[model samples]
Target: MRRNTRRRPTGARRRTFAAVALILGGGGLVAANTYASAGEGDSGGRVQDQSGGDQAATISCPDVGQQLTDVPGEARADVDKALANLDQQITEAYDRLTSTRQEQAQDGNFVRNSILGPLSEKRTEVIGQIKIDVKRAGGTAPEALDGLAACTEISPAQAQKNDGGGDGDNQDGDADTANPGTGQDDGGQGGEQQDGNGNGAAGPFAADFVDITKVQPNVKAKPRRTGDASTGTFSVQCGVNENKVFNTDNLIVAPGVDNGAHHTHDYVGNQGVDAFASNGDLANAKTSCSEQGDKSSYYWPVLRLQDGTKEFDAEQQGGGLEGNVGKILQAKEAEITYIGSPAGKVVAMPKFLRIITGDAKAFTNGTANANANWSCTGFEDKVQLADKYPICPQGSSVVRSFAFQSCWDGQNIDSANHRAHVAFADAEGNCGNGFKAIPQLTMRLVYDVPAPVIENGQVKNPYAVDGFPEQLHKPITDHDDFINVMDEDLMDEVVECVNAGRQCGAGAGEQPQEPQQPEEPKQPEEPQEPQEPQQPEEPQEPKQPEQPQEPKQPEQPQEPKEPKDKPAPQAPQEPQDEPELAPEASSADADKDRAKKPGEAPDAPSEASSAPSDAATRTQEAGAPDDARGGETKARTTSPAETSDTGVEAQSEETQPQPQAGTGSLASTGADLWPAAAGGVLVLGGLVLLIHNRRRNMTTN
Candidate 1:
């Protein structure tokens, strides 16, 4: 009754109630959409989404260097410096982005207006300078380069998509198709804890690692060997930067700029290598290699453990100040091996030829040139991860292997972009477009550090490779550099050993025997025919006369002794058998002697004796004409005996035969003789039967 008197259902009151319900429903829908967008763009455990719907995690710009394929040689220095400056600008911008997170949280437009705007302006000016430098040097600048100046912010999900989604598939189509760990963060520790470093930008988050044991085997089978394939490998024994040679300078990328890499590098080989080093300085520098002739410089990004330890470069631009903090981990083993091509025999690498394997900016620039190969020692054959770092088992060490481009352009030691001069072989191991195959430099770096613990999406004592601050110390950005400063003689040896299909290096002592084996077969073949008849006659003359005369003088009437002496003919056959076993025994003894005396130069003499003895035994087994060829066979057999006694004297004599048998065609003939000798034995047996039958027929007549 009271309501009926107070309000008679006015049209205004009804309209207000419906409007309020509509506003409340619309606000709930908007909140749901915002939360959905944040969840959709989450980058596993790398970063947390901001309240802004379209938040960005990093910056991505077009690679200007990839576009300038034909920069003039004269403009290279200025262009290189300018390019480095562009990198420096991006690093600075990234530094600012990390330092101003609170400002970004307060104002969503702060990153775009204050950070990205100034970065674009600076990049535009540097791009203009690059174009001018090229034009002044009589080279046409790419007009589209101006479009590459503007950069854009990208979400973490977008960054991962650009990098092949961390699926471990490289440009070669080889993939580590393992179910990587659960790449989800529980959102337990947000903000600074997300990156391990207090900086919000620099990171090697929990999502970046996968347990190696769980990874499925993904190593692609090597291309089958063709007739022209260079199958040998040459290893250089440069100690694993034991001298603590560390720097942030990249001589190959930025010759005159200090701290150009913006991350520390571990250096081995040429001791004088630095940003300021000239070609002459490199040539004169002392080396860390066991071979003094190998003065080549080899370097790669240093691995660091994020355990709150400050290093010598803690306050330096490329170290702690740039967010690459912590204790540097020296490689337990840094093995540098140069392998031959699967397509054809590799040519000698040009002196001072610069090679850079893997892209250092792969995180932001995309994975077009990414060649990172990460694994554990025991799991290398099972899985080679390109994007994620491997979590090794307790005893297994972390391994990073880089297989460099095997194809060279033949003309330039380096290109403007530092990549045009070299290229990777195809999946079939063929170099296309007239590219010549060169030694494929493969570097294997092993670290013996404790495994980092990842619990509830939080990583404890994480380890990462040094990289540009914007790259976030990603494993995909792992790279290596090399400059061939090897002396001409040493390089020739490497080429000869590789092309000849013989593994030769400081670590391979047995390789000397391979070359000698080919020569041994040829030497015995040439000297066998002429020396055989004379050698047998010389020894038989003394033995036959002395024995027969002694028996004849005792009994002249013993003419029947001639028949009895028939057994004596078999005595020569026994000596032939002894010669076969004697050389082998001598060679074995020589090897033992060399093994026992470790101080002696074992490679030269041991190979020399073993090779000739093997050749002599095979020749005797082939059944050279009896006592007629005995003297020559005896001479060959005695050589091993003499070598076993005095190694130095034997080496002097053995050296001459090697040069004479250098021709491969001649060496091949030695293997071919086995079939020829078998045929000869069949024919000789038939003749013996015919002669015996004829003699019996004549006696019957």
Candidate 2:
């Protein structure tokens, strides 16, 4: 069987390849351009509104919470002190700007020029100070702190550190760390030149990059509460299939829609996928998951195997990320499921609800990174070292899993950015303070990497995924997103499945019952086209109203002209390609395949109906199952019993390992390794590792 390669080349070949490939592509190129034009480039190229007259410039710094997570106790005080002063100045400036007129608050140029721009400059100055304190404390500054300069919507000093204007290696042409909060750089930063903040310098494109250090797996020891019992569960066997699970850019901007992913990604589910998919489009599109009613879409980046080669040369391609492209492979299975119960009665989801799982900005960050998951398929209990990609046993595939937030804000199905309205359930499966518990959605991605081979009695694995060698150390580019475009009724069924605690998919305890076949209804007679020869008889009528009515009758007959008109002009068929109707038609057809009896009349009478209810009925069963066990909405505030499949259960604190405290002795050193390795030990280990990896590759190949 074909497997995705995870092996990476070492020694001379690896170094040679790294030397030649164009290192600036994706976010790196964007960072470079940003710095090159730092003195001249305006707020991310956005035209500044000349409306607001110049007010005294104020500096508004980013919130400390957004920039750093879990700072060591010893450093938090200094970091907080720096942020406090910066924020105070920003607040004063903001007050001044908004004191005279509220409109000034909305002015982009005014905010950037008077507020954010100054804030960016101040931010840099303070970060430099923080670095001093860190050094004084005999520790290295955190990457999150370094990324503060580019945190604003518009940063005039955006490229200061990346463009070789700041202190240290970051200013010496080394790549910066990824932006805080986001694992990858923002859209404009999609390149290989700079790493965004202060992570490291650019290396070989195909060289292994491990974004995050190995943290304890978030997996639970036992099932834990995912939702309250007051609300009944609804589950959908969102299929193992994929509509377009390819190695390309695919981000869901709206339900059943996508914002073209500039970086390569793995897409699955909805077929009406594009940059402009709306809720209606998602409602209409067919899904590739289980032949069930749920049609939510899910996707993430594609994991490839770098075979010790620089697949793309940036200089040859005029300098771009594609010049670093490597061999992309297909994942074995992309399983996505939506399981949740409504708080009370199921209401239609507010249209176009968007949500993301995992941190995109922290993908390459070593501290507090939540995005990377490393383990062999079956031996999920055993996590490999974060610095090294796992060499799986011959049969198992490499797995990258993503679990999305389930708790909803009851009031709004979505928020401005699509994330504020939804949140992850706490360890007890209870919703956060203001949010209410809803269904949880979890997606699992599995890939089959080439098996290890034995060479001269040594086992070695040498495959790897393509990544920015300068910023990342492992193939840790994993993130997932979802847009809930489910028809309201179908969503209700998903709620029912979750509340009942009944498993509904292949892995779930219960098998998905085949949808009962609905008998076909009688077909209506086709309306014939009105004959042109009959038109001459209409004018003979004496009464004007009667004459008009006679002519209108023919027009009504023309309404049935779709069959003749559409069949004659094939160009009209293009409308079916529109997300509005084609998705529903195809999804309905898929439903029919599972539920409609042979020769049963399709729901043709309602074909012309544009009502969501009409279309929803065709896709799901008419009634919810009564046998499921769960209470109606209760007022109990306490957490409820645990439920959902093995995949949907929440992880309790006992199961989740807490992070260790203190920067410790290692913080003073550059790397996360326990201690500096002696030369002899390093050389011996490298030789053994290289030999082992090479042998495994030789045997597998």
Candidate 3:
């Protein structure tokens, strides 16, 4: 359902409308007094109505980022001109269609013929010329051009028939013939009748605009479950960084309808997000998330708290507030759950899968509010009444949870109805019979707001919020949208990691360029020096005792003799060299090759390797600052400076004074062996002499 009609400018007509308004109003009022053009003035570059006194603005063309980039540079100029002209035509057509009463704007038949049909023709002509120009420019026309059409499309309504008279599964389908109004007209009628008795309606929320009870009984009856309890299911606790989130003034719902819905939305994740954003746009966007590989776009309407105390500015009219809205604060965190069945087997999400949850158009309209979700941070199980938007207490936050349809029909990434090709998963998060499991998406948004107090036994000064639809004026109209633009490789990793029950953090491990070695390598030097000193001490102490006990120093000789096994000494040298090479090897494969060569010792490489890990440990203990991980990773990479340090340590070891005990033991072992050999020869000579003398004496007898 659409809002009641007033003159609103389409996109290109925005400038003209402002100029005309200034002329008609005699320029006596300030710039804020004139009506804003569609898509011209809104927070976050998104067009939505503000409640106040001015006529609603309209949007003109799709954002340039949303356009097809398949057009060659030579044909780009031609396409741009055609698109601009098409935008003009479409905006004019939207103006004509909306030139009726509020009720007429919602008529499916009226909008289809007057607005969508003409716009489609214009779009078709432009696309046809684009194709012709592509061929003319010596480029093959892309297949995307065939499927390309207007994003501003309208559909005929086919209201579902309820067997239980407005109950049962009647709310399942998009085609519903129910004519639901915000009852803005009825409130005035009732007030006029009560005027004579001096009982005028106190405020908008006090009258017919406040009946969310009849509108969303389903949400009040049962809150939807969103999280996956299964082990190995992945969840990303995306921190709230409001500075990175953007607000644009482009309306997403009705592309050319100026200020069709008046509000603002907060956008996170993808930086290049706009209504016309395509898969390419998302893929190319720089994300606010730590996971650079995740290019999915996330957005939701901004929340405003009202106390019925502020006057309206002219620019804030049409959908402007009747009460004072406080300063908007970004949510604290968004808890995102990527659910899959049978743990770790989450299928890679299809590219450009668009998901919308909650009803952005359900302001003050009961029929549109059926599936809305609202609750307090601490009171998740006790869902508040539909009409009552909770004001959180100090220290607590207002929580909004969203569960998107996850089951898919396998072929269509999208359908005529934004949701027809998708269905809800079972309680276990398994896909339904006809549909296969896609990633089950759920996000919980937490907000900080002051609590409303009870006055005269009723809650007062509550936080009220809504979506772009101007007809709806209740906080129950919260909604959000997401578009998946993950890189193919990253998507595969996500599926593998989740199916195998791995807990993957955001940005899906998309690492930045290799970093330079860390500056804090000195910290590791302290521990390494002590460890090296102990190794040399072990052999020196035992060798000192060998020189004193020559024969008994067989033990000492064995000790010196050990080095005689030159191969054994060489083996220890290689392993010692390996630790040095480990650092260089860790950084670059080329360095590893040099270290592996038998001729060169990798002592420097060893120190280089230890430097980074030690530095990382210290950094982690110090509570790794946001940029520390990058610094640590870079420091781990071998640097020329680290190599120089390794050489210095080697030179120091070679030049250091040799232990006296080690030198003496070497000399003593050699000296002892010569004496033992001479003594053995002397004893053999004496035995021979004695045997010859005895034979001579026997002959004289």
Candidate lDDT scores, in order, read: 0.59, 0.36, 0.38
Task: Please identify model 3 stretches exceeding 4 Å from their true place.
Answer: 1-231, 237-241, 244-252, 255-261, 307-326, 342-345, 363-370, 382-387, 391-395, 426-430, 454-460, 506-701
Q: Which of 1 and 3 is ahead in lDDT?
A: 1
* lDDT, candidate 3, 1-701, per-residue tens: 99878877554355444444434333322222333322233211111223311122221223221234345557655655554455446445544533432433234354445556667677777778877887887776656555455534221100000000111121233323122222222111111111111111111132211211122212111112122312223444233433223332222333223233344455656655543444554566555554556667777665544432221111241123211133334454465656444211345678877766545434322332233345553344323333334444333455565656656777665542245556654333445556765655656565555555432112244455634322223444456677777777867765655444334544223211111112112222333333433432332221132122123212211221222233431232212112121222222312213212111111212111111111111101011111111111100110011113443343233223212111223344355344444544444444454455456556755
Worst 10 residues of 2 by lDDT: 516-525
TM-score computed on alpha carbons, candidate 2? 0.41
Q: List where candidate 1 sits over 4 angstroms from the true fold.
A: 1-51, 159-200, 509-701
lDDT of 3 at 181: 22
* Candidate 2 per-residue C-alpha lDDT over 532-600 given as tens digits, one digit per residue, 9 for 90 to 100: 234224322211221111222232222222233333211221122112222344344332233321111
TM-score to native of every candidate shown: 0.64, 0.41, 0.42
Backbone clash total, candidate 1: 6
TM-score winner between 1 and 3, please give it. Answer: 1
What is the C-alpha local distance difference test score of candidate 3?
A: 0.38
